[model samples]
Structure formats: C-alpha cells, structure tokens
Target: MQEFALIMAGILLAGAPLVLATLGETITEKAGVINLSLDGTMLLAAMASFALASATGSAWTGALGGMAVGAAVASVLGLTNIYLGQSQLAVGFILTLLTRDLAYFLGHSYSRQPGPSLGYWGIPGLSETPLLDLLLGRQSPVVSISLAAIALCWWWMYKTNAGMRLRAVGESPRAAFGRGIRVRFSRLMACLAGGALVGLAGAAYSLAVKPGWGRPQGCEGAGWIALAIVIFGGWHPVRAAIGAYFFAALQVSGIYLQDIFPSIPAQVFQVAPFPMMIVTLLAVNLGRVGFVQDLMRRYPFLKRFSGSWPITAPAALGQDFDPKKGL
Candidate 1:
C-alpha cells in the first residue's frame, strides 16, 4: 500500500507540468487563440527560470520571471495574430522554432549547472496524515498551484459570466461582438494568461520535478504531449488533467518494467509513451472515419465510449478573427 501511494505521488509529480500546460492551452483555444509555440515557450521558460533562480537564489522570483517571459511571448502571438491580421498558425510555428533556438543560444552558460530547487511545504495536519503524508508531504508549492489551477480554470470556464464571454469569443466572435463583448481584447487576455500558466509549468519542471538545468533536454517534447492531452481531454480541464495523469502513469510504468525485465533495453521504456500517445491520438479521431462509425453503430455497447471518441474542437480555433467580418 505504501509503495502504491509512492508511485501515485510520483505520477502526480511527473504529471504536474502536463496538467498545467494542457490547461493553459485549453484556455487559450477556448478564447479563440491557438498558441503552437508551447514546446519552445516551455523550453525557453525552463532555462530562463533556472537562470533567474540561480542568480537570485529565490524560486518564487524566478517563477514570476518565467511567467513574464511566457506572457510576453503569448502577447506577441496574440497581438500579431489578432490585431495585425497575420496567420496564427504561421506565427506560432515560427515563434516555436525561434524561441527554442534562442533558448539553446542564450542558455549556453546556464545549461548543466546546479540551481536551487523549489522548497516543499506540506500543510500542517495534512502532511502527517496516513496516505496523504506520502502523497502531499514533500510536494513543492508548484504542485499545489498546478492542482489549484485545474479547479480554478474549470470553475471560471463553466460557472462565470466572464468565462461565458471567453467561450463566446472563441465559439462565435461575431456574435460575441454583437453582444458588446470585446472579442479581440478577450482573446488577447486569454493568450497572455494561458502563456503565464505554461511558463509556470516550465519553471516547475526545472525547479521541482526534474530539477537543475541543461543536458538531456528532458522537457523537449513535453509541450507536444500536453497538446495531445488537450485533444484527448476534449478541451475540458478535468478530462485533460486525467489524461495527463494517465500519460504520466504510463511513463512511470515503463521505467518500472525495465527494472523487472533487465533484458529489455531501457530506451524502449523511455520512448514508449510517445507511440502510445500517438495511438491514443489516432483513437480520439477514429469517430470521423467510416469504419469506426459503422462499428460504433453496430455495437451498441461501444457507443458508450465511441460516441465521445472524437471530441469536437472549439468552433473558431486557429482562424484569424477579422473585425470586418464581425461588423
């Protein structure tokens, strides 16, 4: 039982970044902005946060700096795409490459160096509890923040008027504008906010989960996994978080399996999650194909799962919002 608890905690720790990043993207897409620069943004933020933290010897300050970097990148993407009438996809893709290379170049000095890790602060009584102790006792503040983000985002999106406006802008900007909502401004804000969250995720990686900076570039493909999780989760915060945890569990399982079967190469386990995610991604879209649709129809029981297999994306995602079209 203790071992199981430890494994679950490990999964949560490893999955925190994914949870935060996926939720951030969900918020961005919900507000009608698609930021494809997630991978690069995270990498850059990780390096920047590590450097800042090392310089100041303060984790919180470093996290704030990371958020600023993320928000700045996101703001540029949002403004250029929304106000300047550029293609969001093109701009995002370009920014991804640019930010990634920039991180490598600028972070040359900070790479592979030791820095301060985030401090763990468990709740008083909760930290001493049975299973909870193992689960939450030694967790960093970022883990709690990530979990809280999920709940807060879920509430803000489903239960608030401001959230409704956010959805309105994404789903039908023309209608939202007609209703007197500032569609462009709303989307711009969403992108900035989402980027901040993504930045926090990056910082969490270096300062807590993975620790230290540089070589191995462990965080490289995390952004892509988070994005895939958003799709698998149907853009819902809770569902997306669940997907993140599942993926993390898969990763953990791979590592454990390698120890049990020494004959199997360690690289196989390390790379297993990528292909698994790809297969899951394909499964999510299977509803769109004819054969899968036919199978779903023939096997009534399959409908329980298949009906929601391919979740529909937000109506206006990835499109440039034209003011003239709305007016």
Candidate 2:
C-alpha cells in the first residue's frame, strides 16, 4: 500500500503541470487564439522560476518571473499574428525556437544547482480517506488549485456572457464584430492569459516536479505533450486535464509493469502516446471527407469528433480591419 501510495504520488506529480498547461491552452484555442509556443513557454518558465528561486530563495517570486516571461513571449506572438497579420503558425513556431534559445543562453549558469520544490497540502477531510489517500488525498495545493481553476474555467467558458462573445469571435470574426465584439483585444488578452497559465505549469515543474534548476530541455517535451493533449481533449479544459492524467497514468503503467513486461522495450511504451495522438487526429479529421465521413458515421465513435482541427485562429477575432474588404 505504501508502494502504491508512492507511485500514485509520482503520477500526480507527473500530471499536475500537464493539467495546468492543457487547461490554459484549451482556453486560448477556444478564444480564437492558438499560442503554439507552449514548449518555449514551459521551457523558459522552468528556467526562470528555478533561477529566481535559487537567487532570491523565494519560489513565489520565481513563479511571478516565470509568468512574466511567458506573457511577454506570448504577447510577441500576439503582435505578430493578431496585429501584423502574419501567419499565426509561422509566428508561434518561430517564437518557440526564439524563446527556447533565449532560455538556453540565459539559464545555463543555474543548470547544475538544486532549487526548492513546492510542498504538498492535501484538502482536510478528503486527504484522510483510506484508498483515496493514495491517489487524490496527498495532492499538492497546486493540484487542487489546478482542478479548481479548470472547473472555474469550464464554468466561465460555458456559462458566462463574456464566453459567448469569445465564442462568437472564434466562430465568425466578422459577424462578431458586426455585433460589436472587441475581437482583437479579446483574443490578445486570452493569449496572454493562456501563456501565463502555461508559465505556471512550468513553475510547477521547476518548483514542484524536479525541484531543481536546469536548462531548456528541463521542460523536456512537456509542451508538445500539452499541445497534443489540447487536440486530444478537443480544446476543453476539463477534458484536457483528464487527458493529462491519462497520459501520466500511461507513463506510470510502464514503470509499474516493468517486470511484467520485461521483454517489451520501455521506450516503445513511452513513444506510444505520440502515435496514438496521430491516429486520433487522422480519425477525427479524415472523417470529414466523403468516403471518410461514410466510414466514420458507420463507426459511430468517429462521429463524436465533428469539429475544427485547426492549429491557429482563422482571423484576428472580430477586428477585421481589412481595408480590402471595406472594413
């Protein structure tokens, strides 16, 4: 039972950051802004938070710094794509490279040093539950905070008036503007908020997961996993959190079943999630084609995936100030 407890704790630790980032990304995508710089955001935030904590001995200060860096990086992307009318995909991809290189260069000094990790704080009554104590009971405040945040996010997106405006911007920017929605500003703010959330996820990794200072790869492909989870989750915060946990459990499965599957290379299981994600994308997207649609309708399961598979926003929200279109 103690061993099981430890493993569950490890899984929670692995999942917390993913949950935070995925939820944030889900919100951004829903608001008609796709900040694909999640990798660099996590990488830079991890380095900044670690370095700040190391230098100042305050994890909170480190987290703030991390958030600032992520927002700044994301704001640049917002400007290039949302303001300058550049290809959103190109801007985000470039920002990912740029911020990662910046993190690498700026954070190399702290790579070898150890830093502070966040402490866990279980909820009062719930933490004491017997079997639950092993899994959700010993969760860090970050986990509880993340869960609460996702719930609130879910509520805000699905229940509020602002959410309706945001959805209108995503669905049809011109129509939204015709209805007086401040599309560009809304999308930009959403991007900044999402980027900040991703940065928080990075802080979770630095101060909570590894509890150490390191370089760029310290984030170690977490952002890509998060981006993948965003798609797998269909851009929903609650669903995204669940996907993160699923991924974490899948990773933990390889460890728990190590002796059980001695002959099956562990690397195979580790890389298996990527292939599964690809299959998911293909199944959802290709199902829109004629023959694919026929096959998907026949399959029933693929019918559930009838939504956009885009990686970036189609327009700058409702700020369609295009002179060519007589805006």
Candidate 3:
C-alpha cells in the first residue's frame, strides 16, 4: 500500500506539466479559439526557460521567460484570427511548425547544458502528516501550482461573472455580443492567460519534471497529448486534470511493465499510452451516438450521471468573430 501510494504521488508530479498545458488549452477553447500551436509552444518555452535559468540562476525567472514566449505566440495567433479574420486552423498549424523549428535552431547552443532547477519543498507542518504528506505536502512548486490551477480554473469558469462572459463568448459570440459582452476583447485576454499557462507548463518540464533542455526534450509530443486530453476532459478543468493524471499513470506503469517483461521491446511500452488514449477517446465519442442517447432517454436514472458524459465543442470554437459583420 505504501509503495502504491508513492507511485501515485510520482504520477501526479510527473503529470503536472500535462495538467497545466491541458488546462491552458481548455481555457483557450472555452473562449472560442483553438491555439493549436501547443506542441511548438511547449518546445520553445522549455528551451527558453532552460537557457534563461542557466544564465540567470533563478528557476522562477526562467518560468516567467517561458510564459512570455507562450503568450507571444498566442498573441500572434489571436491577432491573425480575431483581428485579421484569418483562419485559426491555418495560422495555428503554421505557428506550430514555425515555433518548433525555431526552438531547434535557437536552442542548439543550450542543448543538455546544466541549469537552475526547481527542487522539491515540503510544506512545514503538512510534511509531518502521514498519507497527506506523501500525496501533497512534499513536492515541487510546479506540482502545487498545477493542482491549484485546476481548482481556480474550475471556480473561475463556473462561479465568476468574468468566467460566464468568457463561456458565453465561446458558446455563441453573436449572441454574447447581443447580450453586452465584448467578444473579441474577452477572447484576446483568454488567449494571453491560457498562453501563459501553457508556457508555464513548458518551464515546469525543463525546470522540474525533466530538469534540463535537449533535443527531443522528452516533451516533444506532450503538447499534442495535452490537446487531446482537453477534449477527453470535455473542456472542464477538473475532468481534464483527471485525464492528465490518468495519462501520467499510464506512463509510470509503462516504466514498471518494462522491468516485468524484459523480453518485450521497450519501445512498445513507451508508445502504448498514445494508442490507448486514442482508443479511450474513440469510446467516449461512441457514447454520444444516437442509440446511446436513446438509451439515456429511456432510462431517466442515467440522467443523474449526465455530468460524466463527454461534452461537445463550443459553437464558435474555430470561427472568427467580426462585430462589423453583425452576426
């Protein structure tokens, strides 16, 4: 039992970066924009954070630097999509490729270099507690931030007026505008806020989780995984956080399974989580089919569990909002 608890704790620590990234994208999408440059953004932010941290000798400064990189990229995305009325998908894809190449090129000098790191710190009194200490008291600030972000985002999205306006914009910008919300401004703010979180996730990887910068950074595909997790989580902060933890568990299990099955190829274990997540995503979608809806309708008791059902995307997710066009 003790070992299991430790393993779960490790999973939460390891999954912190993904949780941040997923939550960031969730917020971006909730504001009716899709910042698809997450993969490249994370890579560039990781490199920037490591390089800055190495130079300045402060992990927190590096984190801020990384967030700036992410916010800058998101700003470009917002400018093109919201102001210029360009296609969000096209611009996002371009940015992803651009930022990715930029990271590889600019980060050549800092590859594998030693840098300042965010170390584990235990909360004073809480660290003395038993199970709670193992689960939450002793961990890096990055982990704590990820956990806090989940709660804060959930509350902001569901309990605050600003959050309601943000959601209203995503659901139907025209309708939201009609109701006195400033759609474009709200979206831009969400972009900046979400981008900062995404960037922080990258910093978390380089400064805490993996603790350095290098080609392949072991975080190459994490952004994409985070994106999928946002969908798997149905765009809800808490659910999305759970999805991050689930994937983290898969990754940790793969490490254990490798030792138990020495004869099996290690690469198989490494790539297993991707395909498994894909399958889970497919199953979630399958539950939304017509027949499934019929069954839910036939049995009203199932409605009690409706909160668990996967949600569809926002009505204005990828569409450009132009006030001049008048809805």
Candidate 4:
C-alpha cells in the first residue's frame, strides 16, 4: 500500500509539467489560435528558467523569467498570425525551430551545472499522515499550483464573462465581433496567457520535476505529448488534466516494469510511453468511425462512458480574424 501511494505521488509530480502545458494549449486553442511553437517554447523556457534561477539564486525568479520567455514567443506567433496575416502553421513551425536552436546555442554554458532547485514542502498537517504523506503531503509548490490551475481554468472558462467572450471569439469571431467583443485582442491575450503557463511548465521541469539544465533536457517531446492530451481531453480543463495524469501513470508503469523484467532493454521502457500514448489517442478517436457511431446510436447510454463523443476543435481554430474586414 505504501509503495502504491509512493507511485501515485511520483505520477502526480512527473505529470505536473504536462498538466500545465496541456492546459496552456487548451486555453490558446479555446481562443481560436493554435500555438504550434509549444515544443520549442518549452525547451527555451526550460533553459532560460534554469539559467535565471542559477544567476539569481531564486527559483521563483527563474519561473517568472521562463514565463516571460514563453509569453514572448507566443506573442510573436499570435501577432504574426493574427495581425500580419502569416499562416499560423508556418509561423509556429518556424518559431519552434528558432527557439529550439536558440536554447541549444545559449544553454551550452549551463549544461549539467548545479543550480538551486525547488525543494519538497509538505502541507503541515498532512505531511505527518501515513498514506496521505505519500500521496499529497510531500510535494513541491509547482505540483500544488498545477492542480490549482486545473480548477482555476475550468472556472474561468465556464463561469466568467471574460472567458465567455474568449469562447465567443473562438467559436465564431465574426459573430463575436457582432456581439461587441474584441476578437483579436481576446485571442492575443489567450495566446499570451497560455504561453505563460507553458513557460511555467518549463520552469517546473528544470527547477523541480527533472531538476537541472543540460543537453537532451529529458523533456524533449513533452510539448508534443501535451498537445495530444489537449485533443484527447476534448479541450476541457478537467478532462485534459486527467489525460495528463493518465500519461504520467503510463510513464511510472514503465519504470516499475523495468524492475519486474530485467531482461527487457531499458530503452524499451523509456520509449514505451510515447507510442502507448499515441495508441491511446488513436483509440479515443475511434468514436468518430461510422461503425462506432452506429454502436453509440444503438445504445445511447454508451455516450456517457465515451468522453470523446462530442470532442471537437473550436469552430474558428487556426483561422485568421481581421476586425477591419468586419461582420
């Protein structure tokens, strides 16, 4: 039981960065923008945050710096696509390459260098408890913040007027503009905010989850995984967080499996989670197939069990919006 608790805690800690990045993209897409620069943004942010933290000797400062880097990258993507009329895919792809190379170039000095990192801070009362300690008591602040972000985003999206306007912009910018919402501004803000979260995720990676700056970074493909989770989660914060945790569990399982079967090459365990996640994504989308649709229709109750039943992208996603053209 103690081992199980410890494993669950590990999943939560490992999954925190993913949760933040996925939620960040969810917000960006919910506002009718696709920031394909996430992979690069995370890499750059990770390097920047670690460098800043090492220089300043303050983890919080590093975190904020990382967020700034993320927001800056996002701004470029949002502005070029939204205002300059550049294709979002093109801009995002280019930025990914740019930021990635930039990180590698600039981060050479910090490779494998020791730096201050976030330490465990257990909740006072809960830290002493038996199973609870293993599960939630002894975690870094980043994990707590990641969990909180899930609820905060969900509330903001469903219960706030600003969020409504943002959703309006995503669903139909022309209609939203008719309703007096500032479509471009809302999308831009969402991009910036989402990018910040992605940056924070990067900071968390270096300062807490993986700890330290180096080549390979150990988080290379995390941004892509976060992107897939957003689609699998149907753009809902809670569902998306669940997807992050599920992936994290797969990762934890791989580690344990290595111990159980020593004959299996370690590389197999390390790479297994990625392909497994891709397969799960494919399975989730199977609901879109005709036979599956027919099966769901035959037994409507099945819809309740299938979270992907109504999953879809925002109506205006990846499309440019120009206020000057006006509805």
Candidate 5:
C-alpha cells in the first residue's frame, strides 16, 4: 500500500508543471496567439527566479520576477506581430531562440552556484489522511494556483463575450473585423496574457522545481512541449492541464527508470523525453487520421477546438500575410 501511494505521488509530481505551462499556452492559443518564445520565457524566468530567491531568500519574489520577465518578453512578441505587422509565429519562434542564447551568455556564473529549492509543502491534516496523503499530501503552492488558473482561463475564454471576440479573431481575423470587433486589440491582449502565463511556467521551474539556476537551468524544451500540449489539449484549458501532467509524469518516471534499469544507458533515459515529445506532437495533430473528419462531426462540441499552430512558413510557402491584402 505504501508503494502504491509512492507511485501515485510520483505521477502527480510529474504532471504538475507540465499542466501549468500547457494550460497557459492553451489559453494564449485560444485567443489566436501562439508564443513560441515560451522557451526563452521559461529560461529567463528560471534564471531570474533563482537569482532573486538566492539574493533575498524569498521564493515568491523570485517567482514573481520570473513571471515579469516572461510577460515582458511576450509583450514584445505581441508588439511585433500586432503593431509592426510581423508574423506572430515567426516573431515568437525567433524570440525563443534569441532568449535562449542570451540567457546562456548571461547565466554563465549564476549557473555554477547552487541555491535553495522549493521544498514540498505537506498539507498538515490532509497529509495525515490514510490514502489521500500519499496522493496529495505533498502539494506545491503553485499546483493549486495552476489548476485555478486553468479554470479561470476556461471561464474567460468560453463563458464571456470577450472570449467570443478572441475566438473570432483566431478563427478569421478579417471576418471578425467585418463584425466591428477590434481583432488586433484582442490579439494583443491574448499575447500579453499568454506571455505572463508562460513566465509563470518558467518561474516554477527555477524556484519551485529546481534548487538552483544556471545555464540551461530554468528550462530547455519545456516551452516547446507546452506548445505540443496546447494542441494535445485541443486548445482547451482543461485538456491542456491533463496534457501537461502527462508530460510531467513521463519526466518524473524517467528518473525512476534510470535507477531501476541501471543496465540501460543513462543517455537513453535522458533522451526518452524527446521521443515522447515527438510522438505526442504527431499524435495530437491528428488531421491525417482516418476518422478525423468523422470524429469532428460526431463530437460536434469539438467544432470550436483549434489544432497545432504553425510558427513559420517554409522559404517558399504560400502567400504571406500581405499588408496590402488588409491582413
């Protein structure tokens, strides 16, 4: 029974962070904005959170600082894509690559130093409960917060008029503009909000997940996986949360596998996540599936769901978003 409880705990730990970031990205995409720069946002947040926490011994402050960095970076993407008439996907992807290189260059020294990490918060009486304790006795302050955010985003996106406009913009910007809606403004707001959530996701990695910060400290492809999860979740907040947790579980399980199967090469375990991520990407983008069209028709409620968003066109892709065309 104890072993059973331990296994469940392991699954929950794996699912938490992925749930946060995926749901956050899911919200952003629901508004027709995609922030590929999540990678940078996460890395920056990780560094900033770690640095601030180390300097002041306030984990909350560090997390907030990381969120700020993520929001600021996300705002830049919104500005470029909305105001400057840049490709939202291209701008976001570029920002992701740029932020990573910059963090690596700036984080050389800090990466070398180890800092305090967020200790698991064991709920007092709840943890004492027989079976529940093993399942949720150990909760991060942010896990509850993440779940709350997902619920909030769902309400905002689906239960409100503003959300309606946001969805219209994503579905067809020109059609939305024709309806007298402020499509650009809506998109911009979505971008900023998305950026802030991505930031929160990054900060979680630094202050809550890891004990310290350094180069490659805050995040690696966590942001990219968040992107995939958004698709896996069908651009819905709740599904995104589940997708995130699934990814997290895979990650946490990898550690156990490493120890259990010591005969297996460590590098294989290390690279396990990438394959999982790749498979998830392919599986989530099920447009090519045989019953995809039938599935959509059968589940009429899924008509509103969005799928994988493209970040850029090939060197010679179809028509661009021409300003002359009034896009």
Candidate 6:
C-alpha cells in the first residue's frame, strides 16, 4: 500500500509539467495563436533555469529566469505573427529550431552541473493520510502550484469576461473586433501569459522533478507530449490536466512493466507512450470521419455525448487574425 502511494505520488509529480504546458497551449490556441514552438520554448526554459540555478544556487531565481526566457520567446513569436502578419506556424517552427540550437550552444557550460531543487515539504497531519497525502498534502510546493494553476486557469477561461473575449477572438476575430475587443492585443497577452506557464513547467522539471542539470535530458520531448495532451483533452483546462495525468500514469506503468516482464526489451516500454498518444491524437481528429459520422447517425445517443466527451478546439485555431481585413 505504501509503495502504491509512492508510485501515485511519482505519477502526479511527473504530470505536473505536462499539466502546465498543456494548459498554456490551450490558452494560446484559445486566443487564436498557435505557438508551435512549445518544444523549443520548454527546452530553452529548462536549460535557462538549470543554468541560472547552478550559477546563483537559488531555485526561485532560476524559475524567474526560466519564465523570462519563455516570455521573451513568446513575445517575439506573438509580435511577428500578430503584428507583422507573418505565418504563425512557419515562424513558430523556425523559432523552435532556433531556440533549441541556441540552448544547446549557450547552455553548454551549464551542462551536467548541480542545481538547487525544491526539496520535499511534508506536512505533518496531512502527510499522514495515505491517499490525501499522495494526492495533495505531502507533495512538494511545485506540485501544489501545478494543481492550483489548473483550477485557476479553468476558472479564468470559463467564468471571466476576459476569457470570453479570448474565445471570441479565436472563434471569430471579425466578430470580436466589431464588439470593440482588441484581437491582436488579446492574442499577444495570451501568448505571453501562456509562455510563462510553459516556462514554469520547464523550471519544475529541472528544479524539482529531475533535480539537476545533467545527462539524459529529463525534459526532452515533454513539450510535444503536452501539445498532444492539449489536443487529446479537446483544449479544455480540466480535460487537458486529466490527459496529462493519464499520460503520466502510462509512463509509470511502463516502468512497472519493465520490472514485471524482464524478458522484454526496455526500449519498447520506453517508446510505447509516444505511439499510444499518437493514436489518441489521431482518434480525436478523426471524429468527423465518414465512418464515425455513419456510426453516430446509427446511434443517436452518440451525438448527444460526443461534445461532452471530447472538447473541440476553437474554430479559428492556427489561423492568422487580421484586423485590417474588416475585422
């Protein structure tokens, strides 16, 4: 039982980064911006956080540094895409490569260095409760922050006028503009805020989960996974968080499988989650397929539940919002 609790804790901690990244992307997409550079943003932020932490020996400072890097990169992406009217996707992709290579080059000196970690913070009474402790009480502060971020983002996006405007801009810039909303400003704000969250996720990876700047790159590929989880969750904060935890659970289960089935190759277990998530993404996007439509028609009940099950992206996702074109 204790082992199970520990395993659950590990899974939650692992999911923290994904939760943050997915939610950030959801917000960015909701505002009609596609920051496809999440992969690079996370990588650069991770590297920057670790480097700063090792140099200053302060985890908080490192986190701020990481956020700065994320915000800066996001600002550039937003400015070029929103103001300059460049292709968001193309600019994001190019920035991704550029930031990634820049991290590898600039972060060379900080590689394999020791950094301060957010050590465990075990609450006395709360930590004693097995389930409660594992879920919320006994975790590190970073885990708690991730949970809080989810609830806060969900509320902000669903219950606020500002959030409605964000959705409005994404759904129809023309309509939103007619209502006196600043489409470009909203998108730029969203991009910056979303990037900060992504940076925080990267900081969480280095300053707590993995606990150092070294070999193995614990944060590698996380950005891509988070992006997939965003789609899998249908772009809703709560659903996206669930997807993050689900993916983390799968990853932990793979480790267990490696132990149970010693005869199987370890690499297989390691690579399984990627393909599984790919299948999930494909399934989400395939909802409108002819076969799916036919099945839905055959089962009237399916139509009623489809929307509730897989949250869909905003209609204008990835499109450039042009205010000059009568918007």
User: Backbone clashes in each candidate structure, one number apiece?
Assistant: 0, 0, 0, 0, 6, 0
lDDT of 2 by residue, 28-76 (tens): 7777777778898888898898888888988888888888877888788
lDDT-superior candidate, 3 or 4: 4
For model 3, state the Cα shift of residue 121 in Å. Answer: 1.5
Any runs in candidate 1 off by more than 4 Å, and if so which? Answer: 297-301, 308-310
Model 1: lDDT equals: 0.88
lDDT of 1 by residue, 56-162 (tens): 99988888888888898999899899999898889998988998898888889987888898878777887557788888877788778878999999999999999
lDDT of 3 by residue, 1-327 (tens): 667878888998889999999999999999999999999999999999999999999999999999999999999999889999898889988998999999999999989888899988787787566777887777888988999999999999999999999999999999999998999999999999999999999999999999998877988999999999999998899999999999999999999999999999999999999999989887777667788779889997876665466578888888888899895
Q: Give per-residue CA lDDT, model 4, range 20-95, as digits (tens).
A: 9999999999999998899999999999999999999998999999999999999999889888999998999899
Question: What is the C-alpha local distance difference test score of each model?
Answer: 0.88, 0.76, 0.91, 0.92, 0.72, 0.86
In terms of lDDT, the poorest run of 10 residues in model 4 is 302-311
Q: Evaluate model 1: give its TM-score.
A: 0.96
**Candidate 4: misplaced stretches above 4 Å?**
294-309
**Positional deviation of 44 in candidate 4, in angstroms?**
0.5
Measured against the true structure, the TM-scores of the candidates, in listed sequence, are 0.96, 0.86, 0.95, 0.96, 0.83, 0.95
Whole-structure CA lDDT of model 4: 0.92
Model 6 TM-score, 2 decimals: 0.95
Candidate 5 lDDT score relative to the true structure: 0.72
Please tell me which model should have the higher TM-score, number 2 or number 6. 6
Compared with the true structure, what per-residue lDDT tens digits does model 5 show for residues 267-308? 887779768877877855655566875887888765455243
Best by lDDT: 4
Flag the better candidate by TM-score, 4 or 6.
Answer: 4
